[model samples]
Target: MRVTLPLLALGALLLSTGCSGAEEDAAPPPATPAQDGPAEHVFAPGEQITADLTMYDGDDGRRTPFFSGYRPTIEFRHGGLSGECGVRLPVELREFPPGETHTVVLECGTEVVVPADDRGFALVEDGVERGTGEVVLTGEG
Candidate 1:
């Protein structure tokens, strides 16, 4: 009789523990959707644009712009009467001395001339724009 009581207690303890563990191991709830909308814009063919960049280093006693270490990408966007157009330009600059300022021309062309005021340009890195700059768009032959 005494042994029976001890066995009953042990069985009850095991059952309670098993049930609690099952509850803890249940699957988590579904993930919620993103709050912010789409971060990137998709461009149509022929509507895409490109830009030419002339990088100039000022005499502010700063280090010369290094291009060999990193590849710089530029995205130009314009809002006009027709619609909005954007282009990405990849740039590479050779290493220069800290005291010297160098200029490199990037060849970029589009069907239309983006107005100076309506034009917006950005330096892209890792899918994100690191800095902002002005670029002149030229016509292609």
Candidate 2:
């Protein structure tokens, strides 16, 4: 009876430790900005722009540069113009374990026209233009 009690206690302790929390519930550590690496900036004529830029882990171990293991892709719209017009600039990577700041050039088709007065944000894929925005550009240095 005593042996059974001890075993039960041990099992209970193990269970408590093992099942205390879930893997998904744990918060991920804050990620450092890849500011030191290369950056691509562009200006587009549509409300949305897509960028194809390469991100380096800068450390060993299997890691994804972007949040979702994909290239940097962002979409934004101006006031009340959510679905009117949009553009997509998909950035592609041509190399891995980059030796230095790699350049990804993008091509902005002539179909999407950019207004002189409207602000624009272009997606630069590897230092090239890939995607563009249609709104007034702001908040850039």
TM-scores for the candidates:
0.29, 0.19
Instruction: Show where candidate 2 strays beyond 4 Å.
Output: 1-54, 58-71, 74-94, 98-100, 107-141
Best by TM-score: 1
Top candidate on lDDT is 1
TM-score of 2: 0.19
The C-alpha lDDT values of all candidates are: 0.44, 0.37
Q: Which residue pairs clash in candidate 1?
A: none
| Predictions: Cα RMSD each | 16.2, 20.0
**Model 1 TM-score relative to the real fold:** 0.29
lDDT of 1 by residue, 12-101 (tens): 897987743245665889998764432333334345344433333343322445443234555656643122233232354445343443
Estimate the lDDT of model 1.
0.44
Residue 87 Cα positional deviation in candidate 2, in Å, after optimal superposition: 14
Model 1 segments more than 4 A misplaced:
1-65, 68-71, 79-104, 109-113, 136-141
Clashes of each: 0, 19
